[model samples]
Target: MGWWKKKKSRAVVKEQTWDRDQWRGEKILEALIQCCDGKPNSIKFFTADQILKATQKHFCKFVFPNYIFMGNGTLDNHRMILLRKMKGRSPHPPRDICTGPPKDVAISSMVSDHKNFMKLVGCCFEFEYPVIVYYGGERQYSPVDLNKIVSWRRRMKIAEEVATALAYLHVAFPRPFVYRNMGLKNILLDKNGVAKLNDLSYCVSIPKGETHVKLTWAGKDYDYMDNDYIFNRVVSEKTDVFGFGVFMQKLLTGEENFEELCGWKNWREKNKFPKWLSSYMGEGRMGEIVDPKMVLEEEERCLMEAFLVLSERCIGLRGEVPKMVEVAKELRRSLKQGE
Candidate 1:
């Protein structure tokens, strides 16, 4: 009886291993089907062993918080960013259980030509979901590390680059994709201090002939989402503009939670600027609103004021918001004037 029980236990272990292998194979096939635009060769597939070896088996080097790790690849000898998707979590519908990583891979591959966008190096499908790989940078830019980005001029440059990338997403493809998530967390800085926009999990496309698509909010926080999107579920380029406005405010004030600004809680009812911003602007105290950590020269004050004005326009009412292309042009002009 003891010998028979041991044989049954070994059979169960072998069966579990086979089930895992089968699941991995199915997920890899699904990712390939979804992301294989005419140029399937654009996405390279790495084995699970390769990813583990690159990440030092235990993922010792932390890049971004929780999910992302930095590693030196054994096969290619290149530095890489490994993005691991956590298991047993379903943020979308049942049909979309394992779609986020593949969707991000597809969008990253599509925008690979752009300089300000994160470059997708490859992916591994040895787990329940795919593990994405991208070209790594020195570090990620976050609100906590505001001291690292101390110059208003540098902030404007980063803003301009991000705006340009958003504009490209709007017009460079057959169908326009709305980047529903835009914040400091999604912005990465390379070794050369150039900002790269990443994390396209929430990116959605507008159907042909449609100006906007209705989508349930997939982000973890509502602070940066536009009123139109939060209330109506409507997603368009304007949605991105509104989020960009919030991002710019964070960049300017160095505040992680911009909603804490005075009268912000009531601004939705009043449909106007927050009391703190309004009072500061009325008093001509731009210095008070700008990030204290930033060292702004006399000439750069005017540039900051212009940037704030543009940001306000972005978060303004439906008819008042400027398109991303116009925003990009305005930011470029401001950068040139500051120079």
Candidate 2:
């Protein structure tokens, strides 16, 4: 009888919580309707909670043609909406004159350079900061938060493709771009297994010959950067290289936090590569370090070894670090060799 009472009480509490969430969802739905001028055409309205479950954000997806508008409300005082509109749009989504350059500019500049990027769909400036719409992708196909981790080969492929895309940004662009906010969370692997790098808010374009650019505020992705950017506040292509190295480490070691990365940094500073890595390279101990989820088959070992070496150089000091173009070349070589 006591258990029955407890279960009943718990049921009541859950019902109440759902009711509250439903009410909140209704409010956002109302805002969406208002934003659409009472006729939100060909648009899909996702509840904030549903969007949270999907994107881990408070934003509800106002998905429309060539854009996904993720934001809290439909008012001028609402939270900023991240818009990823399509090509040749104005620089940055509309914003007040005082908020500095609109962040969409980074994304615009990115997709403008290459399709490997997620396109900026554009933003509406009725609000103070502008409600943005980004180009659409398979939201369900986002590989960041999957339940079953795939093979390392698959993941390494994703990393390789992203490295090539980054190279295009840093090298192919008339003015080199420094992608600041780089992390696994922002790299989306679609259903087709192609990699798409998103979140260009911190990306900056600097002059061709400049070694480093001064930063006003560093991003959490700074964990991916070298000590120079994290400690000295100097950003450069090397900073991006360091970040990419950290990303590779994430795949190799499963060390989620940057603080646990002393091995890579120590190797960079002292040239003391990990014994386990050496063993894997020479003694075929790939299983010891490779993700348990991955088999790291004999045929694939050479590719992994080359990738590991490339990742290490990506973390090296400025003089030792290869250009993004060079990094892309090495990754392509690894892929071709493995093939």
Candidate 3:
């Protein structure tokens, strides 16, 4: 066999023989090294204390259940993350498996088609504690990347990147995933202000035996706020679309109107939803609805308006939103026209 084929064969063998016990720790180290792409390891193994001390000044003390912290440090001025080993909370019983002629073959086949997902940058099963290392800086609300904000070309690139990432999550192999907490803080922006969706602690896959997932929604915001914090509902992909709509609305108006929009008394009495947008559409008050910091020229205005229309459609879904891919396609088409 050729050298390339030999190399491929070796790789497969190596993968097959990979020790699950050493998976998370080694792979996390490798992923961190790759992110640096050149930084020599000053410290071989990271301890949780070292990470906490390094980030004591800023590491927000909010830990989600199930996931644990691995480590965090700075490399080339960018913040890095080494997170806990990931595993599903629920356990699948042995009876869930179907038997075949050969036991090894059946085990391999069963593992190959296992539905529970644990996504990390590199290796899996590195110790019972999963370690996932990624590099990013602190979150800031300012749209620093003017390229992703002011320039149409840059904004389009950002949009495409976000769309692609969301598409990957929503349409991964075997089954699709829906992120429960799809929000601004959940969206991490690189230095370029390009959004990368993060914090998938709320992700859920469509179960193997289920056809449709039930959805529930808590009245818009809790405690009289316009924030898109919903609860008291079983959720699905459409729920994500609904959340996206609220995000888009915020992008457009730079105002918080969720309380009025989602309030039963206010919403039913006066159709208060899309508070700012409704006025703009009815009275050609685009300037009133548009974000003040985001001054748009005529062309930009058109593009923004198109996106607003798309957002309106998304929000209208209530509990019946379109697929994210469909919404993305429609947004893309609208953007092309605006351009």
Candidate 4:
């Protein structure tokens, strides 16, 4: 090949490599890890000079609307980044990534401890790939085995972790944090089988509003539906209490039909949640409503019953959703007695 042609080809390759390195920042890398099955084998790192070359072409792609996934497994592990990169054309800009309507400013403003919980050691970056890193517990055994061991004990542990996290969200902080999307995927477990909450992206601050009030329906199909209760004012702490009640039912009965069961339609038709759960609990048949994997001792049956009753009251009571402090207190008492 001619010298000029060979030189041009080599330059192109260098640019590609440089571009990949620049995109490997923390925000993109975090997203990549969320979607990855497991950690990569190794990752790349770069100096600031190389970072410019690597990010120039691909940076604009993610600036305002078009978000990019950094550690998508498609990228070679050697080129991942551990820190968040800038998407703006300006050399210096305030944190521009999380641009959205600040409805939940209270929740969003908290200094998230995610970075500390999973302490990042180092990272590599690439344009079309996730920035890789050597994180805390990086060499630890993956929790792949835990997913296989579904027992009563494990399920209860999961339930407690979720409940505690939800309780914290509902009451522990000075201000309430509303997690709009609470799901199994958003729950994380440590090496010790203890669970914690993750993914606060959709979390928002509860707006000022009344308790157990109806909201306005934004859709047209609900013409006949009661407009007073369908949709109206903003959600508050009580709304979270209701969500936790539904979540408790999901954990207990192992049901995935929370919307159908707790919706206005069913709730209106049969407002006997407390009575129904109480009947089941009184019969020592908490298992009937609980996940089959969770096995409770006969002695612990009453504790489970209390929890169920509280959950029922959570939804059944209109103006008086029990405070998280009280709820935790009751749960503590029940668990203590059971133990």
13-115 in candidate 4: lDDT tens per residue? 5476564344324333443343222434222343433443444423332211222222221222334322332222222211322211111121222322332
State, as a TM-score between 0 and 1, how close model 2 is to the true structure.
0.62
Which candidate should be chosen as best, given TM-score against the real structure? 1
Model 1, position 205, has a per-residue lDDT of: 79
- What digit string (tens of lDDT, one per residue) describes model 2 on residues 1-339? 111123445356445446443443343344334222354323233332332333343435644333344444232223233443332323332221111224333234336436566544343332212233444433323535323455666667777777887787687646566776677767765557778776554566665577767765564444476777766777788878778876776676565322233464555567664322433444756555665555556777667666777777787732488888888777777777776
Task: Please report, as a residue range, the 10-residue window in candidate 4 with the lowest summed lDDT.
Answer: 97-106
lDDT of 1 by residue, 41-155 (tens): 4777776567656666565555555355454433346654645453343433324222465566777888876998877777665444556676654444332246678888888
For candidate 1, the per-residue lDDT at 41 reads: 41
- lDDT agreement of model 2 with the native: 0.54
What lDDT score belongs to each candidate, Candidate 1 first?
0.68, 0.54, 0.45, 0.42
lDDT of 4: 0.42
The true-versus-predicted C-alpha distance at residue 34 of model 1, in Å, is 6.5
- Give the top-scoring candidate (lDDT): 1
Clashes per candidate, residues 3 or more apart or on different chains? 0, 12, 8, 33
C-alpha TM-scores of all predictions = 0.81, 0.62, 0.53, 0.51
lDDT score for candidate 3 against the true structure:
0.45
